[model samples]
Target: MHDVVVAGAGPVGLFVACELALSGCSVLVLERDRDPRPPLKALPLGLRGLNAGSAETFYRRGLLEATMQASGAEAQEVGADPEAVEAPGPRALSHFAGMTLNAADVDTAALPYRLPSPAMEGFMTSLDAVTSVLTERASALGVEIVRDAPVTAVSQDDEGTVITAGGRQYRSRWLVGCDGGRSAVRRLAGFAFEGTEPLFTGYVAEVVLADPDQLPIGFHLTDSGMYLRTPFPGHLGLMDFDGGTFDRSQPLTREHLQAVLRRVSGVDVTLDEVRLASSFTDRAMQATTYRMGRVLLAGDAAHIHSPLGGQGLNLGVGDAMNLGWKLAATVRATAPDGLLDTYTTERHPVGAAVLDWSRAQVATMNPGPNAPALRKLVHDLMRTTDGTTQVYRQTSGLFAHYDLGDGSTLVGRSAPDFRFEDGTRLGDLLHNGRGVALDFTEGRALDGTAQRWAGRIAYAAGPVRNNLGFTALLIRPDGVVAWDAAHTPDRHAFERAAHQWFGAPSRLTTGAPSL
Candidate 1:
C-alpha cells in the first residue's frame, strides 16, 4: 500500500515528496536524518525559512530557473531595474538575498525571483543553490527517498495508513505529515499543536568578513536584544541575542560571534569560519487541526512561528504548495472531500496571521516599560510608506487571501496580474501544473465549466491587465482564488467554491461512477 507516505525529508518533507512524485503518487520518503548530507542541507536560513513558496512554488514549472542553474547558484546582476526587474513590479528587487527585511518597502514586482535578498536575511549561496535544485528535482520526480527512516509507530484507521520503521512496515493510502517542529505525524495524528514557546532563543551566524566594510548592509543593534547586520554574496551576516536558553554552556562563540560583530559593526572582523550555528525557540505552534481523516498536516506540521516575519520557511513552503495540489487531486480520485477541506480552510487564517505577527515582533523586541517607547513607535512605523507597506504585507508571502464566497470576484482578493492577449503573464500562464480560468470578457461560461473539469481545468481567458477588478478568476492547484465575480455570500456555502477550491467536484462514493 503506497500512494503517499511522506513523513519528513525536510524542505517541507522534500517538497511533499516532490509533489507526490509528480502527481502519479507512489511515494515513500521517510528520512529521520540519515547520511544524506551536503553543505548542511545546502545552507538555508535567515529572514525565516523557505522564502515563501520556494520561489513562487518552484516558479510555476521552470523549476525556479532550473533549480538555480542546477545549484551552482551564482547569478549576480543584483537588481536596479531589468525592465523594472522583470516587469510585474510590486515586489521583485533582491540584492542576492541581503537587503530585504522590509524590502525597501514592498512591491515585490511579482514575487518569485528566489534570491537577491531575504532568505531570512541573506547569504546562503542562493539558498544552497535553491535547495540543490529542489533535491535534484525531487530525485527526478520519482521520489522514493528513505534515509534512515526514523518513525516509531503511526497506525491509522479506515483501512490504510500504517508506518513503523526500525523494523519497517510502511503501508499507505494517505499520510503527509511533512514532519518537523517535533511532529511525529502531529503526534500520531491525535492532533493539537497549540502555541507559544520561546521565552527567547535565537543565536545564528555565518561569518566571513575582513573588510566587507565591516558590516552595514542592513544593520541593526539593540541594547541587549537585537543585533542583525546583513549582506551576503561573499559574506557578512550575523544575528545575535544569544541568551534566552542559549547555553551550549555559553555557546554562540567564535569568541561570542566576534564579540557581537565588534559590538554591532564598529568594525574589527575576523571570524571567517563558523559557517552555520542555530538555536531556535519561538514557536507559536498551530496544528490544533489540519485534517485528521487520512492523516494530513503540512510544513512544520501545519504551523510553528516566531522566525518573526520571515514567516518560517515561507509558512512551510506555503504548506507544501498548499498541500501538494490538494493531495494530488485527492490521490487522483479527482477531488471533493470539499477539496480536502479547503486545506484547513485556507491555511488556518494564514496561520493565525503569522501568530499575530510573531507576538507583535516579540513585543517590539522586548525590554519592557514601554520598550523604548515601543521601539520608537516601531522605528517610526517601519520607516513609513504605510509602515513599508505593512512590512511588505508581513514579509512578502503576499498576504495570502481567500474568502471564496459571493458571486466571487477573485474571492477575497490577491489574484491580479493578468495581461495576456498573447504576451503572457497571468503569472506566466498560471505557473505550471495549471488550472486557471479567469474569463472576464465573461463569454467563456467556464466552457461548460471547462468540459466539466476535464483533465482538471486549464482554460485561460482575456481582459483585466491590472485594472485590478474582477471579471472572472478561478485559479487553484494552490495558487488560491477558488472562484470569483467580485465576491459575496459564504456562510458555509457550497456549490462551486471554484470547483471546491480547485479539485473535488465530480464525485460519488457508492453509486460510484464519479472521477
Candidate 2:
C-alpha cells in the first residue's frame, strides 16, 4: 500500500506528491491523461501568472529557478548578479477586467513590510513549463506517477482509502483529489460543492485570420460582449454573456468562431483556420469543506472560478503548499492534534477571497448601464498611489494573511526573505522542507528552545539587513510565520509555538528537553 495516493498529475498533484516524497512518504500519483503534452498546455493558450506567494513557494522547494528557465526567462540574471545594471524599460502592468495598472504607479514604500529580494513579484509562464518542472522535481524525489489511470470510484474507512482506476484497485493511507474543475473524485466522494452560476461563456482560440488587420490589438468592450485580440496575428479571446448558452461540448469550427467573433467584436473578421479552441465559464463553485473522511481535495477539484485575473493556478498551488506538510506529518503520525484540520480552515478563506475577486471583476465587465461608470471609477482609482498599492497587494498575493491572533505584524503572514549577514536569505533555509526558528538577535533563549526540536525545526541565528520590527520569528515549512516577537524574547511563548507546529521534541533524540 502506498502512503498517499494522489489523483491527477497536474501542478498541484505533482507538488503535493513531491512534498510527501521529500519527507520519505511513499506517494503514487495517478493521472487520467496518458500524454503529458497538449496544445492547451503550451504557450499563448496555457499562459499563467505566478504571484509572489506562489513564486516564493517554488523558491522554497528549489524549483523556482528551474521553472523560470523552462519558461524561457533569463534565469541567470534574476538573482545571480544583483549589481548588474540594464537599460530601463516600460513598467509591467497587471490587468483587472481588461483594465491595466502600471507597476510604477504603485508606491513600494507604502509596503514597508516587504523585504528586498532577488525573486520577482510575479511572472508569466505556461502550464507546460510549470508541469514539466514539477514533474521532474517529483520524480527526483522518488514519487511514482502512472498515466491513463483515472479514479472511477473511491471508498474510505478508518483503516484506509481504496481507489479504483483503470480496472485496478489501489490502497493508500490517504487520498487527495487534484483533478480539474469537473472532478470525478469529488463527485464519487460525495463532496458538497456550492457556488454562483456562470454569467457568460468565454472562448479562447488560436486561428488563422484572413483579414487580421480588421481587428485591433488588445481588449475591446462592446454592447454584445467583450473581446481581445493578442499581438499574435490569429489569436483571439471572446466573452459572450448569453447565460453560457453556447454548446461547449461541441467542437468549435471556423464558421462558428467567425460568427461569435463578428457578434462580439462587431467586425466581419474572417477565420480561415481554427488551430485550437477551448471554452470556459464564470461558473464559480467550491467544496463546503476541503476534506471528507480520508479523502481530500486541492486545486480546481476543491474550488474553481473564472480566470479573470489568473488567480486559479496560483490559488491551487497555494493549497498544495499549505496542505502538503500537514498531511505528510499526519501520515507519519508525528503531527499534533488538529494540524490537518488547519489546512481547510486556513485555505478555505483564501479560496473564497479569490472567488469574490473574480466575481467583482465579472461585475465590472458586465455590459450593464452602471458597469461603464464603475469601470471608469476603478480605472481612475488605479491611477492613484493608494489604489495601485491595494490592487498590487491583492493581485500579487502579498495581502493574504491568516487570522493567527495577531501580536506582531508578521504573525500569520509569509515570512519575508530577509538577507542575513552570512549572505543567506530566509528562503534558502526552507529548502529542506522544515520549519525555521529565525533568531535575529542570536539570543540564547530561542536557540536553546530550538535545540529540542533540532531535526524538526532548523534554528538560524543571524543579523539581517532589515528585521521589519521583528526580533525573532517561527516560520512553518510553508513559509508562514507561526509566531514572532518584536523585541523582548518570550521563552514560554516560543516553546508553546514549537510544540504547536512541530509537535513535541522527538523522544528518541538524546538531551531533548520537555516542552
Candidate 3:
C-alpha cells in the first residue's frame, strides 16, 4: 500500500506528493486529465502571481532555481537590468481588486523582520511553467502519478483508506484531496464546505478581436459590470454582476462572450474568432475541517476563493507546504500527539482571511453608487506610503503569520532568510525538509538540545551580523520559526518547543527513524 494517495495532479497535489516523497513516504497521485499541457494553461490566460511566501516555499525545497531555469529565456526577458537603479516612487507589483499599489510608496524599513533573500516578493508566472516544474520534481522524487484517473469514492477504516478511481481501487495509509474546487474526494468524505455564493460570473477568454482599439488596455469599471483588456491581442477578461447565472458547465459560445464584453465595456467590441474560454466566480468556500479520519483535504479541496489579487494559487500552495511534512510524519509514526491537527488549526484562519480579502475587493469593485466613493477612498489611501505598504505586505503574503501564542516575536513567522558569516543561508539548510536550530552565539545549549532530535532537526552554529535581536532560532521544516531566543539561550524553553514540534527525544529513534 502506498503511504499516501493524492487526488489531482495540479500544482498543489504535485507539491504535496513531492514533500512526502522527499521524506521517504510512498506517494501516488491521481489526475482526472490525461494531458498535462493545455492551451488554457498558456500565458495571458494562465498567468499566476507568485508571492513571497509561495516563492520561499519553492526555494526552500531547492525547486525555485530549476523552475526558473525551465523558463530561463522568459526570465531573462523580465530580469531587472543590472545597470538600472530603481527610481524612488511606487512600483506596483500587483493589484487589489483593480486598484494597483506602487512599491516605491511602500516603506521596506517598516518590515523590520524581513531579511535579504533570493526570493522575490512578487512575480508573475504561467500556470503551465509552475505545473511543469512541480511535475518534474515530483517524478524525480519517486512519486507515482496516474492520469485520466478521477477519484470516485473514498472510504476509510481504522487501518487505512481505500480509494476508487477510474474503476480501480488503491489502498493508502492516508488520502488527500487536492482536486480543484469541485473535489470528488471532499464530497465523498462528507466535508462541510460553507461560504458565500458568487456575486458575478467572471470570464477569461482568448479571441480574435476585429476592433481591438475599441476597448481600453486596462481595467474599466463601467455602470453595468467590469472588464479588463490586456496588451496581448484578442485577450479579454469580463465580470458580469448577473448573480452568476451563466452556466459554466456548458461550452461558451463566441456570441455569448461578445455580448458580455459589449455590455460590460459599453463598447461594441467585435469578436471574430474565439480560441479558448473559461469562467470563474467569487464564490468563496472552505471546508470546516481539513482532516477526517485517514482522509484529508488540501488546496482547492480545502478552500477556494476568487482570483482577485491572485491569492488562490498561493494560498493553496501554502496549505500543501504546511500539510505535507506534518502528514508525512504522521504516516511514518514519528509525529507528536497533535501534530497533524495543527494543520487545520493554523491554515483555517489563513484561508478565511483570504476569502475576506476577496470579498472586500468585490465590495469596492461594485458599480453601486456607494462603491465609487469607497473606491475613491481606497485609491487615495493607496497613494500614501503607509497605505501602499500595508497593501504590499498583505497582497505579497509578507505579513502572514500564525498565532503561536506569545513567545518570541519570530515565533509563528516565516524564518528570515539569514545569511550567516560562513556564507551559508538559512534557506540552504532547509532544502532537506528538516527543522533547524541555528545558534549565532556559538552556544552549545541549543545545539545539544537539537541533537536529541538529530535526524529530524539540524543544528548549526554560525555568527551573523544582523541578529534581528535573536541569538538563536528554531525553524520548522516548512521554514516557520517555531521558537526563538533573544540575546541569551533558553535551554528549557527551546527544548520544550523542540518536543512540541519534533516529538520528545525518547520517542524518536537514531539515524532517521524508519516507517
lDDT of 3 at 258: 89
The residue-level lDDT of candidate 2 at 363 comes to: 83
**Winner of 2 and 3 under lDDT:** 2
Which candidate number has the best lDDT? 2
Clash counts for the predictions, in order: 33, 0, 5
Candidate 3 lDDT by residue in tens digits, 87-198:
1222356787787666777887777676666664556777888899999889899999999899998999999999999889999999999999999999999999999998
lDDT of each: 0.60, 0.84, 0.83
| Alpha-carbon shift of residue 185 in model 3 (angstroms) | 0.8
**For residues 1-515, what per-residue lDDT tens digits would candidate 2 score against the true structure?**
99999999999999999998988899999999999978898878887878766877898888888888898875433342343222121135467888877778877666656665556456778899999999999989999999999889999999889999978999999999999999989999999999999889899999998988899998888877899988766778899887777737667888888899999899888888998989999998999999998899999999999998789999999999999999998988889898999999999999999899899888888887787788889889877878877777778775678887666678888887877766787888898888988887744457676778877788787677777778888999999999988877787899888888888886343332221
**Which portions of model 2 miss their true places by more than 4 Å?**
75-93, 507-515
Tens-place lDDT per residue, model 1, 1-515, is: 88888887766777777776766778888878666654444544433233433555665554655654544443632122322212333433222112233455654453432222111122123334555566777888777778778888887888679989756889998888877777887887789878775656655566565666655566354554554554544333443444345524465667776776675455666676666665566647788779888888886777876555456666777778778877887787777657777778878888788788877777666544666887776777666656666655566564566665544434554454455544455556554555666665434444445444545656665554343445555667555666555433221332365556545444322211211
Give the per-residue Cα lDDT of candidate 3 at 169: 98
Better of 1 and 2 by TM-score: 2
Q: Which ten residues in a row have the lowest lDDT in candidate 2?
A: 81-90
